[model samples]
Target: MIPPALRIRGAVLVGPQEVRDELWVVDGRISFTAPTGTAARDVRTVSGWALPGLVDAHCHVGLDAGGAVDRPTAEEQITTDRAAGALLLRDAGSPADTRWVDDRDDLPRLVRAGRHIARPRRYLRNYAAEVEPDDLVAEVVTQAGRGDGWVKLVGDWIDRGVGDLAPCWPADAAKAAIDAAHAAGARVTAHCFAEDSLADLVEAGIDCIEHATGLTEDTIPLFAERGVAIVPTLVNIATFEGIARGAEEKFPAYARHMRALHARRYDTVRAAHDAGIPLYVGTDAGGSLPHGLVAAEVAELRRAGLPAQAALSAATWSARAWLGHPALTEGAPADLVVYPADPRADVGVLAAPDLIVLRGRPVAP
Candidate 1:
C-alpha cells in the first residue's frame, strides 16, 4: 500500500545551493508545500540534511568477473547498491538481460548500456559481444536498440602481440559505430584505460568514457571541447596495482603501463577536471569489485582534487542531471538520502545515510 505523506524538515538540499527549510513527499513525488487535503495526523515527519538519491554513473548491475549471473545474484547486487543510497545506476554494460529489474520498484532504477561490444579475444571472456571491425556498426545498432539509450564499447585492451594495452577499434570503425549508435538515439561510451584509444573515441563523437585513466593533457582539451563526460571509477583504478602485479611475469610491458597509470591516476583525473572535462562517480562494481562503493567512489573523487561540493555533486545533483534524472525537484520521484550533518561539510556522511527514501517510501533508516 502507498504510504501517507512525509513531512521532511531541517535542511532540504534540493540542489547544490538551493535549500528549503522543509518539504513533503506526497503521492510518491516531492512537493514543496504540504497537501491541502491531508490532515496533520496523516503526515509522518523526518528531519535531516537531505540530498537526492546518489547516482552510480558507470556500474554493472547483472555482471560479475566471469559474466552474467542469475536473477537472484543480480537482485543481491541491486540491493547492495540501494542500501548504499545509490537509487540511480547507469549500468555501463552487462551481458545479462536485467530488464526484469524495472518491474521491481524496491530495486534501484537502472539506465542500461545493453552489453559491451569488443573485438574478438580482446575483452574479458563472456563479458562482451566480440566482433570484428566489419561488424562493429551492426553490433552497435543492435545494442543501442536493446539498451536504455546507451551503448558501451571496449575501446582498448591488452594486445598479446605487443604485450601492452592498445586501441581495440580503428578510427574509422569507431566513427562508424558511434555514428550508428547516435543515429539510433543512443549515446556511446567506451571502456578505456590507456592513452591509445582516447583520441579515436572522442573524435568519433562518443558521449562518455569509463575508467578514463588514459586522459592526458593532450586529450583533455578534446574531451572538454566535445563536452564528453568521464566516470573515473577511481575505486576500481585503485585495484590496478594488483592487476599489474598479476601480469608482471607474462606481460611486462602491460604491467608497467598499468602501474604507470595507477601511479598518476589522481593527477590525470584532476587535470581533466581542471580542463573543464566533466567527471562523475562510478565504482565499476560487479566485475571483480564488490558492490556498494558509491560513497567510496565519491571520496576518491575528492582525493583526486575535486572540491567537497563538486565531489559530492559528482554522485548527487550534477550526476543525476547528467544521467537525465531529476533530483529533489518538485513533482519528481522521491528518491533521496538524508544524513545527520550536511554532506557538503564532509562527504563521509554519505557512507552512512541516516535515512533512505525510495519512491516516497522510507525504505531505510
Candidate 2:
C-alpha cells in the first residue's frame, strides 16, 4: 500500500531555516508547497522538531566482531540502526557484500567503502584484503572499483615485532595506493589509532581518519591544513581501557600507550576542533560496539567540548553534507526524524525520536 502524503508541521528544519510552519512529503520526495488535490484524510500530519535523518559516518552492516556475517544478521543490524533514527549509514568496511540492501526501500540508505585494505596479518583476521606493500596500489584500485565512492585502509595496527602500535604501510606505498584510489574517482580513509601513521597518511592526501586517538599538536595542523576530516568514534574509544587491561600482561608498552591515549581522548578531540580539523560523529558500530548509538556518539562529542549545535550537526546537517547527501532539501528523498524537543538545546532528546520517516513513509521509532 502507498504511504499517505505527509504534512510535517510545527517543526524546525535544522539547517537552511527556510520553512518553519511545515513541509510536505509527496511521492517519497520533499515538497514545500501543499498538494493541490489531496483530500484531508489522505494526508498524515506529524508534529515536533524535525531534522535531516541521522547519519552514521562509520558503521559496518554485514560484519560482526568475529567478522563477515550472514544476510539475516546484517538485516538485524540495519534494523537496530533504523530504530535509532539513523536513516543514512556510511559502511566504513565490511568483509561481506551488502549490495542487496540497496534494493530494499525499508532499509537505511548506505554508502559502502568496500572491504578494508590491510597488510598481511597486520589487521584483524578475515576483515581485510590483506596485501603486501608492493600490491597496495593494485588492491586500492580494485577496492575503489568495488566500493561506492570511497575506500578504507588500515593505516596502523599493533606490530607484535615492535610490541606497540606502528604504521602498517611504508610512506611510499601509502602515497602510491592513495594516488591510485583517487585516479579511480574514489576518496580514501584509513583506520588510524597512533601518532606515527597519521602524518604519513595526511601527507599522502588521505580524505579522512577513523579513531584518530593519536592526534597531537604537531599533526593537528597537518590535518587541518590538508582539510582531512576525522571521525573520532569516541563511543568506541570508551572501550580502550578494557582492551588495555586485556593486553597489559602480554604487551605492556602497547597497553600503557592505549591508556594514555584514552586519558586524553576528550582533550585530543577538543584540540583537533580548535585547529579547524573537520570532525564527524561515528560510532564504529558493528565491531565490538553495538549498533544504534549515534545519539551516544553525539553526546560524546559534546563532552569533548564541541558546542551543543556543533555536536548535533556532526551527526546531522554537517555530516550529511560532508558525505554529499542532501538534507531537508526540496526534491530530495524524504528521510528525516522528528524529536519531542529541540535536540540542539539538549542532545539527550535524540535518544527518543518521536517519529522517523524513511523515503516519505513513517517508520516505527
Candidate 3:
C-alpha cells in the first residue's frame, strides 16, 4: 500500500544546481507544497541527499545466457535492480513475455523492446526471432506493435563463414525495417559491435545503438548528426577480453577483432561524447552479468571521460528524459534514491544508497 504522505527533508538535489529543503509525496505522487488536511503527526519524514530514481536504459530482465528464464527468476532479477535504486528500467530486449510486471507496484517500472530480431544463427540461441532479409520488415512491424514504443534489431554479429564481425542486414532491408517500425509508432535500436553496420543503421533512422564499441571518428559524426543515441554498456564491454579468449581457438580473426575493440572502447566512447553523441548508462545486466550494477556502470562512464556530474546524469535526469519519464517533478511518481553524500562530487556513492523510495513507499535502506 502507498505509505502515509511522506515529507522528504534535507538536501533534495533535484538537479545539478537545484536544491530544496524538503518535498512531499501524497498518494504516490510528488507535491511541491504540503497536502491539505494532513496532520503533521501523520506525515512520515525521511532525510538525506536525494536524486531521481536511476535508469538502466539497456538491461534485460527475463533473459539469461541460455535464453528466456522462468517467472521466479525474472522476479528475482527485478528485485535485484530495484534494490540497486534502478527505479526505471528500459528492457533492451528479451525473448520472454514480461507484461505481468506492469501490475506490480513494488517492481521497477519497465519499458520493453519486445524481442531481438536477428539473422538466423547469428545471435544467442533461442534469444531472438531469427529471420532472413525477406522477412525483416514484417518482423520489425510485429515486434514494434508488441513492444512499448521501441523495437530492437541485431544489426551485426560474427559470421562464422568469414570468422569475423559482419553486418547482418543489407542496407535496403534495414531501411525498409526501420521505416516499418517508425510507421508502427515505435523507435528502433540495434545491437551493433562492428564499424560496418554503423552507417547503414544510422542512415536508416535507427534511434539508438547498444554496445556501440565500434564507434569511431568516421561514424561518430553521422550518429551525432542524425540525433541518434548510444548506450556504451562499458560494464558489458569489459568482458570482451574473456569472450575473445574463448573463441580464439576456432576463430582467431574474430578474437583479434574483439580484443582490438575492447582495447579502444574507452577511446570510442570518449570520442562519441566529445562529438555530441548522446550517451546513457546501461549495465547490460541479466545475461551472464548480474543485476544491480548501475552504480558501477556510472563509474565506468566517468572513467571513460565523462565528468562526475555528467556521468551521474547518464543514469538520472538525462536518462529519464530520454526514456520519456519524469524526474523529481510535481505530480510525478515519487521514485527517488537517497545517498549519504553529494553524488556530483563522486558517483561511487550510488553503490550504497541510504534509502530508496518507489511510488511513495520507502522500499530500501
Using all chains and alpha carbons, the TM-scores for the candidates as numbered come to 0.98, 0.97, 0.97
> Where does candidate 3 have its weakest 10-residue lDDT segment?
35-44
User: What tens digits encode model 1's per-residue C-alpha lDDT throughout 152-210?
Assistant: 99999999999999999999999999999999999999999999899988888999999
Estimate every model's Cα lDDT from 0 to 1.
0.91, 0.91, 0.92
Please count the clashing residue pairs in each candidate, in the order shown. 0, 0, 0
- In candidate 2, position 364 carries an lDDT of 88
Q: Enumerate residue pairs that collide in model 3.
A: none
Candidate 2 C-alpha lDDT tens digits along 304-352: 9998878888888889999999999889999999998878789999999
Span of ten consecutive residues with least summed lDDT in model 2: 11-20
Q: Candidate 1 — what's its lDDT?
A: 0.91
Q: C-alpha displacement of 198 in model 1, angstroms? A: 0.6
Q: Which of candidates 1 and 2 reaches a greater TM-score?
A: 1
